[model samples]
Target: MSYFCGSYPIIEKKALAGQIYSYTLLCPQIAENAHIGQFVQIKAEGYMLRRPISICQTDKEKGTLRLVFEVRGGGTDKISQLGAGDMMDIIAPLGHGFTLSDAPNGKVIVVGGGIGVPPMLDIAKKYGENCTAILGFRSFDRIILDKDYFATGARTVLCTDDGSVGIKGTLAAPLKEELKSGAAAVYACGPVPMLKAAAEEARLAGVPCEVSLEQRMGCGVGACVVCACTVIRDGKKQVLRVCKDGPVFKGDEVVF
Candidate 1:
């Protein structure tokens, strides 16, 4: 896929808990080109490496893309300083995206944990009532986008490790329950353990599954080889660049 590199205006900005932020950028070409499960690389002032952030939402007709990201380190911290009306240097529509569907069944279930929740919002909106979102967070304060998921008209299940809000544990039990009924596919993005569990559940349920990975990246494209992941394809285990080949991959393909 072709990528566009430019400075875009930040049209809206909002801060969420844990130094997490939602910034809506008015980049017509990038918005039109972006896909769900893809990401944007933001060049932070004074940083040699750009920060790779997941694309939270996209409004192509409106020529905007919403990016939700946490302040992880120096690069992201520099980015957090920017707000509405600021020009953000970005290269976007990067990385492989989720396969919307590969199942005969029409319903899909999306699983997200912590900062991983944003991307699932778009998928749920696409599936509407046919989507069930099993979201896991550290605690209530850690929760973000539950309302957004609800706005998508999907059944939203919130699970927190601390039981401060929603269910008292991880997504395993609820996910298993949701799969029992019937689902066309399962999609996930979170920590490796969460991804592994979700993939395992989907495998047991006989559902096609895909997952987005969170990796340390240097170049947001294929160049730097900083974000490498192992996967099995055609019976051969191979190393792949997460930024180029995928931040998204088939659940079965990932070695985990």
Candidate 2:
């Protein structure tokens, strides 16, 4: 059975960062089966394709699912206006998430840039003290979820390009320091540049790393090929759909 088999009612909406909004939807079915790093497809009032959004946090006790997203285009703008009691079509818990077992007891580092931190937040929550969260935004006004990460008791690092919040630099420099200090594995989600830089740092440091890719989707299910991505295996390139194979993939396997 589909987790989001019917329309869900929106319970609340709040701004998390600069131009970023987080919506909490009330759907018992979805809230029950939702997992960390999974996403949902929401059908806009007049749009043809549904907008895919990651599941930020699921509150089973309250039967709510929170989704955080950026307002970069038209589809998201329409979503930002939704208020309490608004109804939406959501198909949830889609795509493969991070492989948590890959790190086990080692120091697991999570790196996020801009809107990418939404998916990794839950992962850090589950890992508890063993997790290290590195969050970066363009400026101070763009930061989100720092307190939550710190509250997890995980060692949290903050960075910004314009010196607005934490360290004033790219995530790579501190990440290199973490790896040198012995972070066993790293997982990241963010812009292509940030993912690439994280992968490079991991490679140089000999740390195992995985990355979650963000791509446009026509359908959250496996039906459409709109979210196609290329992966390199055995020195050959193969095509994979982000909606089906993964929004999360091993950093070394993906072909930029």
Q: Which of the numbered candidates is closest to the native, going by highest lDDT?
A: 1
Task: Give the TM-scores of the predictions, in the order they appear.
Answer: 0.97, 0.93
Query: Candidate 2, which segments miss by more than 4 Å at Cα?
Result: 1-3
Q: Assess candidate 2 and give its lDDT.
A: 0.84
Model 2, range 1-256, lDDT digits (tens) per residue? Answer: 2455478898898888778988888887788887667788877777887888888888888988988888877888887778778887778878887777844857889999889888888878877798889988899888888887888888889999999788998899989988887776789999999999999899888888899888878877878788989999678898988987888888899987
What overall lDDT goes with each candidate model? 0.92, 0.84
Which consecutive 10 residues in model 1 have the weakest lDDT in total? 98-107
Q: How many residue pairs clash in model 1?
A: 0
Write model 1 residue lDDT over 145-212, tens digit each, in one string.
88899999999999999999988888888999999998999999999999999999999999999999
Q: Candidate 2, residue 81: CA error in Å?
A: 1.0
